[model samples]
Target chain A: MLQAAFVLVGTIFFAAVVLAVFRIVRGPSILDRMIATDMLVATLICALAAEMVQHEHTRTLPVLLVLAMTAFLATVGVARYVTQQDRPGGPQAEGGAAEGSAEGGAAGDDAAAHDTTSGRAAR
Target chain B: MSAAELLDAGSVLFLFAAALLSLAAGIGIVRFPDPLSRMHAATKPQILGLVCALVALGLQAENGATVAALVPILAFQMLTAPVSAHMVGRAGYRTRHLRRDLLLRDELADAIDKAHADAAHHDVEPDLPGLVTDEDTSTPRP
Candidate 1:
């Protein structure tokens, strides 16, 4: 039963990788491509975990560490790159705080929102 | 079948279920119409998938070392994924890469426009309080 389920899960995650690759290739916008790549990283982690079951091995755990860390670094790097052109008070001056706080559907001013978050992060 | 083998089979089923959750993330990334929604696609299910898979891996591990090492990886992933998603979403919003029509509500648009308007009028305060010159700085008359 373990072997059977391992094979089945492996096949499904493989299909997921193929679809993520398709999106990375055909994505219409830069952020779209980034999102696809992030999903690809996630699927890769899942695949690795499934194979850990297949081989009945646990020594490959370090690979999972490196993958998750690098995926995060890549995402933050590309995001900063995308917004590099914005001036401090440009039309999108409030983008960072606005979008982050907007995730909670808040109606607070951007500066105030950031002030609170940064304070909390500092603590 | 042995009891240990039965236990391994159950964990493998968990691995399969996590694979399915990750499949939903991939499909949502490809099919979601905009960056914010795509970000939504990329975060929640991805984190859940990783947790589920990691849990199954832990269950299958006979050695304590591997399970101990896996804990930090899980912690780091939980910490960073949301921060990365927030950064990406903000960048997309700043660059106007979003499809406003697809968004249910945009609280940022007007706030951004207002910020710009306030900036154009030179109403923003710059936070430099330490610098002083003889021309604009007056000394106390003792």
Candidate 2:
């Protein structure tokens, strides 16, 4: 039964990792990629715990602790940098041009136009 | 079943649940339309999934020392997940990475606009403490 459980959990984790990797590679924005990275890390932590449980060991628990403690730094650092880039005075204000193609059905131009108009109204 | 077998069974169940949450997060991150939505997708596995995983580890631990060592992992995850999510969500909003049309309500934008209006009435730049400038929002560059 334990062996069966491990196989089942391993298959699920494998599928989850694949999906997260797909999002990371296909991101239209850095933030999307960052979010996917966060998910991937969480999955990693869970997988580590699953491994420890299966092997009946605690050696990897410290790795789990370190990962949980530091993973947020990447998200926070990227977010700060993105906000800085968005500022007019900040370097490379036109950073959006390099931002890969939009995901399907989003109509990037229409969204950009709507955002500017609404933003103006807000201001 | 013996007590040892019962504990093993419980640990397997908990681990299974955590893996399922990870799978859900994977699907959510890909399918969600925008950064903020994707952030929502990522947070569940970061918190609840970690909790379930750690609980499973604790159950399978051979001694109190091992279980004690698991506490800090859960604590750190709980402490940091929201901080990172908030920062990312704020950045996403400021950078026009969300689907404005899909939003039923945007309290942050309304609040920012209200602050802007108030600052404008005072005849000064819309600068509120902790609130950034409208320059970022003035142009949509997604």
Taken over the whole model, the C-alpha lDDT of each candidate is 0.68, 0.77
Clashes of each: 0, 0
lDDT of 1 by residue, A11-107 (tens): 8888788878887886545567788888888888878888887788876788999887778888788777764223222233344434444455332
Q: Pick the candidate with the highest TM-score.
A: 2
lDDT of 1 at B45: 43
Error of 2 at B27 (Å): 0.6
Classified by CAPRI criteria, candidate 1 counts as acceptable
Model 2 error, position A45 (Å): 0.4
- Please give me the DockQ of candidate 1 compared with the native complex: 0.28
**Considering every candidate listed, which one attains the maximal DockQ?**
2
The residue-by-residue lDDT of candidate 2 on B24-136, one tens digit each, is: 99999888876778888887779888889888888877789988888888899989888889988878766666666677887877888887899889988876444434454
Off by over 4 Å in 2: A83-110, A113-123, B128-142
TM-score of chain A of 2: 0.69
Clashing pairs in 1: none
lDDT of 2 at A64: 91
